[model samples]
Target: ALAYAAQAFQIPCVVVIREDAQLTKLQAIRRYGAEIVLVPLAEWQQRLELEQQRRNLHLVHPFDDPAVAAGQGTVGLEILDAIPDLRTLIVPVGGGGLIAGIAVAIKAQRPNLRIIGVEPEGAPVVSESLAAGHPVAPSRLDSIADGLGAPYTRAFNLSLIERFVDQMRTVSDDAIIEALKAVAQQAKLVVEPAGAAAVAALLADAEIERPVAAVLSGGNVDMDRLGSWLTR
Candidate 1:
């Protein structure tokens, strides 16, 4: 998305991606003419900051900046516009920006509505942070959902999530794959694992109330991966 925006304005954009980031996502960024810097998964956050400082780049942080969160809030507004009577919102969380932004927007207009966040079990940083009542960093991030493998949530994002979100749940890779298959077969949506996290939670739990909506956030999986998972 940032790459596309930069392309629109004809600005040079550099994306610092984890070494293990999805090949499809890397290809997409390159297609938008963005320069890519691959950093080790453990050092990505530090390298991103250093790169910004060294280049004097105008950093559009993935989840930390208020401006980015505000932009993501538009998704919430659109959701309400489409479903005014929505009782529950299920959002997939990585660094918590998207869910934070959505929660703020939805809670402002509909405080009574429930907002739930879903995270990959392998990298449930948001879930752990919320449980600890503070920001918590995961020791390691190991998930098929590369987009949902954030190592930690920043304080600002965590605060917003704590304030507005009602619950946080996690789904295993198996559950996520199952949900991805279901979405493809039933909903005819070819979604990536991160995109299916919310659906995974919804399918795993039967107690969630009616009028629920799950955000499908991406569809940039490698074809080989999709084929392998589908055949499995």
Candidate 2:
């Protein structure tokens, strides 16, 4: 959606994804007119090539860019506009961009509103980072929530979470799968695992306050695997 927003202004963009990334997400990025590159792993070499070419290009880090974070905060603004009396927000954390920005925006307006974050148990980047008082990367991450598979969080994003967020939680892949089904059956939302992370927390034996808004972040499930996964 962020890339789509950029393309609306005719801003040429190039997106890099893992070779195994969801086909639905890749196709959507291409549909927005952005160039796509599928890499095997961290392709810093290709990034260096872009720097050499320069072309006045600013490499947009997906979640660490200040502009990107601010842009994401608009979701919080929209939610407040629609539900002024909302008391809590549950957002999925990958690299902490979405929740950090939302916390900043909502807390500025309603300081008392609780802001909670959830991530797949396999990749507890934010929670682990907070615990160590610094960013920490996991050696091996395994989860069905591919969208929440960021290896680590940046220091700036970590600081923002430390300042603004109220709680950080982790849920298992099984929990995410259950939440995905619940959203599909109960809410008619076909969300990816990462998108269902917050809902997963909600579905657990959690002590949550009412008037809560849980952000369903994405729906780009790989159609090829969607049916089998949904059935199981």
- The candidate scoring highest on lDDT is 1
Candidate 2, 148: how far from true, in Å?
1.0
lDDT of 2 by residue, 1-232 (tens): 7479679898877776767788899989999887876775466346635643676666677688788788899999999999999988999999889888898999999999999999888989889999999998855478888888887789989999999999899999988988888898899878988899999998884578878889999999987666776788
Error of 1 at 71 (Å): 0.8
lDDT of 1 by residue, 24-115 (tens): 99999999999999999789889998989999999998999898999899999999999989999999999999999999999999999999
Estimate TM-scores for all models. 0.97, 0.92
User: Which model scores highest in TM-score?
Assistant: 1
Query: Against the unseen true structure, what C-alpha lDDT does each candidate score?
Result: 0.92, 0.85
Clashing pairs in 2: none
Residue runs of model 2 more than 4 Å from their true location after superposition: 44-56
Q: Judge candidate 1 at residue 67 and give its lDDT.
A: 89
